[model samples]
Target: MSAWLPIAPCTPRDCAAHEGARRAPLAAAALLLAGCALTLLGVACVPGVRLLAPSLRDRLVRGWAYAVVRAFGVRLRVTGCQVEPGRPATGELVVANHVSWLDIPLVAAVLPARMVAKSEIRHWPVFGRFAALGGTLFIERDRLRALPGAVHALAGALAAGSRVAVFPQGSTWCGRDGGGSFRPAAFQAAVDAGAAVRPLRIAYRTPERAPAGAAAFVGDDPLAASLWRVVTAAGLTAEIRVLPPIPAGGEPDRRALALAAQSAVASDSANRPAASVHH
Candidate 1:
C-alpha cells in the first residue's frame, strides 16, 4: 500500500490514474449491486424469510458487509471476538469508539444490533435507507432532548430482545492526534436500560503508504477519491475486535459505566488477541 492514502476528499493524482486505468469496474459494480441486494434482503427478512434467525440479523449483516468489501477488493480481518461466559446474555447495548463509516458494517458483522446513528444517516443515499431497514435508530445528538428519547427507545428495544450498537466517541476520530475517545452519551442508552455494553474497536490498516489523514473524509479529500483509493489500493484491511462485555453493574450513572466500558475497549484493542476467520 502507498504511504499517503486519502480517505474521502483528497486523492493522489497518480493513485487516481492508476485506479482508473486498472480499476475493476466489475468489482465495484458487484459491490454496488450487492449493497442493494443486502438492503433488499433485510426487508425480505422482515416477512418470514427466516434465513437469518431473530438473534442473527447482526451477523448476517456482517456477512453481507464482508461480501461487499470483498467485492470491492478489500479484505476483512476480525480478531478478538468472544462473548464473556458470565456476561449478560445476548440482547444488549454494544458500544465502541467511532473510527470510520466502515465501522457500521464491520461491527454489524460480529454482533447483530440496531445501530444508534445520527439522524443525518437517515438521508444518506443508499446506506441510510438500508440502515433504517436494518433496524437502525437515528437520533438527534442534543443531549438534553435526545437523552430521554434515546434511553426510552433503547430500553424498549433491549427489553424486547434487540441488540443495539452505539458509537460514544461523540464524534468520529481514528485515535490519531489523540482524537478518539468514548463519549458518555454513547453508553447512556445501555446504562439506562441496564443492558450490558460490549466495547469494540475498528482500525484500518492500509498496505499502501497513504498519509495519516488520507483515508479519512475530513480535510479537503473528495469522498469519491478516498473511496477509490481504499477500493483500488491493495492490502487495505478493516479489522474489528469485540472486547469483553461490561455488565451494567447496577450503575445508574451512564457516564461512569460508559468510561469503564470505554477503557475495556481500549484495552482490548491494545492488548487482546486476534480473531479467526469464519467462512
Candidate 2:
C-alpha cells in the first residue's frame, strides 16, 4: 500500500489577510456578477435550452470560470494528466482530494463535470444560483432522509451520461499534513452507478510563502483578503493532477483502488511518469 502526503500547507493567514484587503474591489465585482451568471445559466435550463447539451454549456461555463480565476490573478498549473486511449462514456464519476473551497472552479477549468456540492452552497447568492443552473448536484451532509434522494439524483445523472465530480475526502483539510483522509461514502455513487472513478489531486503552492489549511479564509480573515494575498503574491501556482481511470468493479476492492489513486497523486515528482498498473 502506498502512503499519501500533501505537497504543502495552507497559505499564512496573515498573508491572505493582507492581499484580500487590496483586492476588495475585484472580489466585490466577481461576487456581484456571480448572481448574474447563475441567472443566465438558469434561463439556459429551459426545455428549448435544455436541448443544448449540458456538457456543451458546461464547457462554456468552465471557460468563463477559468477566465474569471485568471482575471482574479490566480494561475493554475496542471500536471501528470493521463489521457486514456478510449474515453469512457459520459456519467463517469470523478473522485478527487478535497483541499480548499477554491477547488470547485479549479477543477471545472479542466473537465466538463458537475460538482456534488454541499446543500448550503445552494443558498450562496450568485454561486448557488449558477451552480444550480450548471446542474450541480447538492447533497445534504446531515438529514439522512435526503441522502437517498440525492443519491438517486446523482445516479440518474450518471445513467444519462453526465460526468459528476465527487470529493471523496468529504471535507476540506489544512493540507496533506493535516491528516488528509478520504471518506469512503463519497465512493458510494461510483459503485452504485457502475461508473469509472477518476482520482484527482490538487496542490496549491504559494510562490514566496507557505500553504494553509481549509479554514485559511474564515473568521476575521475576510474571504476577499485571503484570496488576493494568494493570487497577487508573485507566481503562486496550483498543481492539479488527474490519475488514470479505474473501472469501478472487480478484485482490487474499492479501498485498494482508492490507495492506488492516492499514491499517484501523493508522489512528489510531478514530472515522473504515471504508472499504468492493472490488478
Considering every candidate listed, which one attains the maximal lDDT?
Answer: 1
TM-score list, all predictions: 0.74, 0.71
lDDT of 1 by residue, 8-73 (tens): 222244222232223466665565556546645655555342445554554455667666556555
Judged by lDDT against the true structure, how good is candidate 1?
0.59
- In candidate 2, stretches whose alpha carbon ends up further than 4 angstroms from where it belongs are 1-51, 82-87, 176-179, 208-222, 250-257, 268-279
Q: Candidate 2: lDDT over CA atoms?
A: 0.58
What do the candidate models score in CA lDDT, each in turn? 0.59, 0.58
Query: Per-residue lDDT of 232-267 in model 2, one digit per residue for the tens?
Result: 444445557776677767324556656655665565
The TM-score of candidate 1 is: 0.74
